[model samples]
Target: MPIHSFLNYLALEKKYSQHTITAYLKDLNSFQEFCNNEFDKQRIIEANYAQIRSWIVALVNANISNRTINRKISSLKSFYKFLQKTKEIDSNPLAKHKALKVPKQVQVPFSEKEIRNAINLLDEEVDFESLRNRLIIELFYTTGMRRSELINLKLTNLDFANETVKVLGKRNKERYIPLLKPVQNSLKKYIEVRNEMNTNETYLFLTKKGKKIYNTLVYRVINNYFSSVSSKVKKSPHILRHSFATHLLNEGADLNSVKELLGHSSLASTQVYTHSSMGKLKEIYNQAHPRSKKN
Candidate 1:
């Protein structure tokens, strides 16, 4: 199928992660299914903007959010663009299409106190799983790496002597993150316990059965640990990463430095975490600003 060629282009040329490729495939398949059911059109490649508009209406009527509908349309737009590139379509159907407006989503990072409490809870247990979980949490908070990067982290990525970890970020880009003392200590302890497990897995994290850890399990570990301390609705690895970047900026880290640490190609992507540090900025302004110092 033509879609397979596009998927291969994404994988081989674009160098997208499997998780990302899978999401793209899912979105395309969803649109194909919609076209099949509504317009009896088996091939979504030939679908026009009018049919796509009907699908959007159906999605809205079915209670799907505008953000989700926009994402589906984005995938379709990319597909059509690919078709244009391959000479399958002369004119792009969604070349001039405008995306639906989506409300801004602000992700609240966990507070420093909450992070401390969560770590304290993890420190109570002495088992391999507990140590591994604590290390994962520390890695996220200290390194600011994504969950996917953490999961795919290899043992060879660690450079204890230099106190840096090599992280493979989006599009298979590699960046080295400096390791803090606490994180280094956690790694040492976790590795000691991990070695006793006798597993031959190359990945950094693993389950009790000595296999590599999955995405859901990493999320569950974060959620289950943080639920005891945080009252926030979202308590996952991404939140920990958010907390990491937010807290660093709050402590007066440079925006460009944070951007590099977070492996963001552009400052705009890293700028999202700056919002979480607004309270700290206000506090600093109140204390240091000459106007605020007057009685």
Candidate 2:
């Protein structure tokens, strides 16, 4: 297999990030395993078109979602293209490959008042965990950071005087988001109680034992808090982010500015929040307009 050369190309020549490289390697490794099982072949360089087709069919057989399989197909296309460019293979098999179809997006987010109530519910509780939960909710709602960025946050990233926290976003890019005054006050209270816990961890959010918080723990905490506050909306960390973007859009913030704040790679990605705002506008229109209901 020319996997070595391709990996080197991705790492050094292409400069793909470690996370991306890992995903590519993982997909190739799965394909390698499939090749070994189906044709008693370990090296994929010897794989014929039929073998490649079998791998695609196998992914479908494994009940992988079309989106996931499509990503894997992309990895394969890149891998084989590397093989061909390096003169390891005669032809690029994945050039004609079809990706599995992915369904359209249908994300539903929370209303602004519902979000405030959710955070307020967390505020009513009286414990270190509760305080921390409140702080987490505030930070998510205020900053609109991704779950990974929130989990990766350290005490050092927060600047009390500057009123901002530097977040490391996707592709290892750095962005500073302004921390809201209310969120800052809650953080101060949380820190006071956190210090009382006497944990040795340097991370902002932590377990009772003093270890840094995991992504799942943060998700579950936010999920539980949101569920307690609102039965109508689906509560998740991403929803807080969605709520943030939607709220900003509703306030007549520039779309490009929101794109930069959210660290979106393109304006098209940020445009979805406009739809979120449009939905809110429709609700307002329905309540105020005489033609709204059958009454």
Candidate 3:
């Protein structure tokens, strides 16, 4: 099937991450099923905009969020574009379609004080798990790495001599992030305890059984710790990432530099942090400007 071929293209030619490829495949399969059931169409390439619109209407009636529906639409659009590119189809059906308007969601970063307090709450005992968790938090806050990047981190990636850690980001792009003195200290301590396990795991972070850490465990670690420190509705790895970018921008870091640190492919993705920084700017202006505050 062309869908299978397209998925192969995404996996091999595009070099998309497995997680991304899975999502695309899921979206494509969902659309294909809809076309088969609703319009009795056997082939997705034979679908037109009206059939696509009917499926979208059904999605809306099913109460799926517009943001999610838009993502599904994007998946279909990519598929159709691919079909056109391969000459399987004469034209793209979604060429004139506009993305659904998603409401702006401003994610609040944990304050520096909140982060400090959270770190302070870590157990004073320096066990492997404690050290590993501490180092994980520190790495997220200091380096702004995605959870996947952190998960795939290897012992060889940490360059103590150069004070940097190389990260394998999305699409297998590699970037080096500088380590702060505190992060370096934590890493050293964690390694000291980790070595006592005597296992030859190449991955930096490991489970109690000396296995590589997975996504759920990482999310739980972040959520469990941050739940005690901040009252934010969401407590996840990405929040620490948001805190990293927001805090850096608040401290006067340039946008391009922050973009590079976060491993964002484009400046536009990094621009979202500026909204959080704008709040800080307003606060500074109100406090420092003459006659800014009411008597």
Q: Give the distance in Å from residue 93's predicted Cα in candidate 2 to where it truly belongs.
A: 9.4
Question: Candidate 2 — which pairs collide?
Answer: none
* Clash count in backbone of candidate 2: 0
Q: Report, for every candidate in turn, its global Cα lDDT versus the true structure.
A: 0.92, 0.84, 0.92
TM-score, every prediction: 0.72, 0.65, 0.69
> Per-residue alpha-carbon lDDT of model 3 for 1-295, expressed as tens digits?
8988889888887657889889999999998899889877667888888988998999999999999999999988999888988999999999999987889887989999988877887758587888999889999999999999999999999999999999999999999999999899999999988888968899999998999999999999899888898999989999999999999999889999999999999999999999989977898889999898678
Q: How close is candidate 2 to the true structure, as a TM-score?
A: 0.65
Q: In terms of TM-score, which candidate is stronger, 1 or 3? A: 1
**Model 3 residue pairs with clashes:** none
Error of 2 at 204 (Å): 1.0
| Best candidate, TM-score | 1
Ranking of models by TM-score: 1, 3, 2
Clashes of 3: 0
Q: Each candidate: RMSD to true structure?
A: 6.1, 7.1, 6.0
